[model samples]
Target: MTRSDDESRRVYATQGLIDLLLERAAAADPARENVVLDATPAGEFDADLGVDPATPVLTHFYLPAGRAVSDVFGVDLGTPAGRGRARFLTHPQGPAELTRRDDLAGVVLLAVPPWGTETLTAFDRQGRRLPLTVLDAEPPVESLPE
Candidate 1:
């Protein structure tokens, strides 16, 4: 198989893993109600090409915001319940600009609970918390694509 074909397979496998995770999360929590699985992008890159021809992909999965505030931190944010309480505050910088900037290529899985509005968390492809913030609770917007 060609290099491009291998890369495509890898990307597909990665997406499958992410899909499985979301499915498990939904099954684990029936109340999870809204589960969104954004699609990852497929592409080609050249090493000889100047500037790493990478890209940033944002896959946002919005759930309801929870209603409990915990002084406890550093918990496993990958859990369905845990991520429900987490929010993406900011990136390596402050919590100002978290939008796609360059071809860095990253995946964000956001879980906003339905009950509360002050929760937000962004997880990486490996389900690790990057940064999060808690704001005034707001109802989850039902804008996710089916």
Candidate 2:
């Protein structure tokens, strides 16, 4: 696929992600539902936990300005609801990794923080805070000692 095709394909993929998250949220039992968040954009990040590539990655974006606002979203990745929020922190993207914005920094936990809304906005400039999630975080590169 060309660059345009790739970009277009992502549009569809992102849409699908929204659908799944709504389902998960509705059926979410606070006792069981859990989401993940990276403290910082530091290094590489992860979008999908362990599901297939088709599984949509979740995201939250503020409208108008398209800046990131803390919100929670999720998917029962690679497991059943009984597992209860299996999202574990990977890299230190939160405060521990922040070179700036420490006031907004936090631990890179799998659970998304509560935003007092049902949806997580991934970039709805129109102003709909649907729990938009994404799994497009890049993984850390491994380097060997020289």
Candidate 3:
């Protein structure tokens, strides 16, 4: 069966989550940076995810360095039945204080109206959602040097 607009939106959100996870993992640790998108298990499907009923998408990003690091942020996205759920995990020690005047820590979440469009969301270590303004339109720059 063809996917619905809601289904497509959820898929887009989930994929965006996966991308963010990978980017963070790579920045936090180069060696342990990896992302896995697994098909949802038969009985583990949640109606709130907003995706296809037959296929549940589970994305996981492994960051070995982040295991013990404080002041870190973890994000996950899941889609079931065309709705998207975004989650943010913060380190116990909280985010590090900014030593530089230009330093900033924040998250941005965007949802396209009318459904079936790509949704964008971001978060900081504090699990707060940042506003998406025209100034934030530029794509994220690489955190690590090539």
State the lDDT of candidate 1 residue by residue for 22-89, as single tens digits.
45444544333323333322223212222123422223343423323222444323335523321222
RMSD per candidate (Å) reads: 15.9, 16.0, 16.7
Worst 10 residues of 2 by lDDT: 84-93
lDDT of 2 at 87: 24
Q: Estimate each model's TM-score.
A: 0.22, 0.22, 0.24
* Alpha carbon deviation, residue 2, candidate 3 (Å): 9.6
After TM-score superposition, the amount by which residue 122's alpha carbon in candidate 2 deviates from its true location, in angstroms, is 5.1
lDDT by residue (55-79, candidate 2, tens digit) is 3333321112112322222432333
Backbone clash tally (model 3): 16
Residue 126 Cα positional deviation in candidate 3, in Å, after optimal superposition: 38
lDDT of 2 at 51: 39
**Model 3: runs farther than 4 Å from truth?**
1-23, 29-32, 41-43, 61-146
Which prediction has the highest lDDT against the true structure?
1
Model 2 ranges with Cα > 4 A deviation: 1-13, 35-118, 122-146
Q: After superposing candidate 1, which stretches have Cα over 4 Å from the reference?
A: 1-30, 34-36, 40-53, 59-108, 113-118, 124-127, 131-146
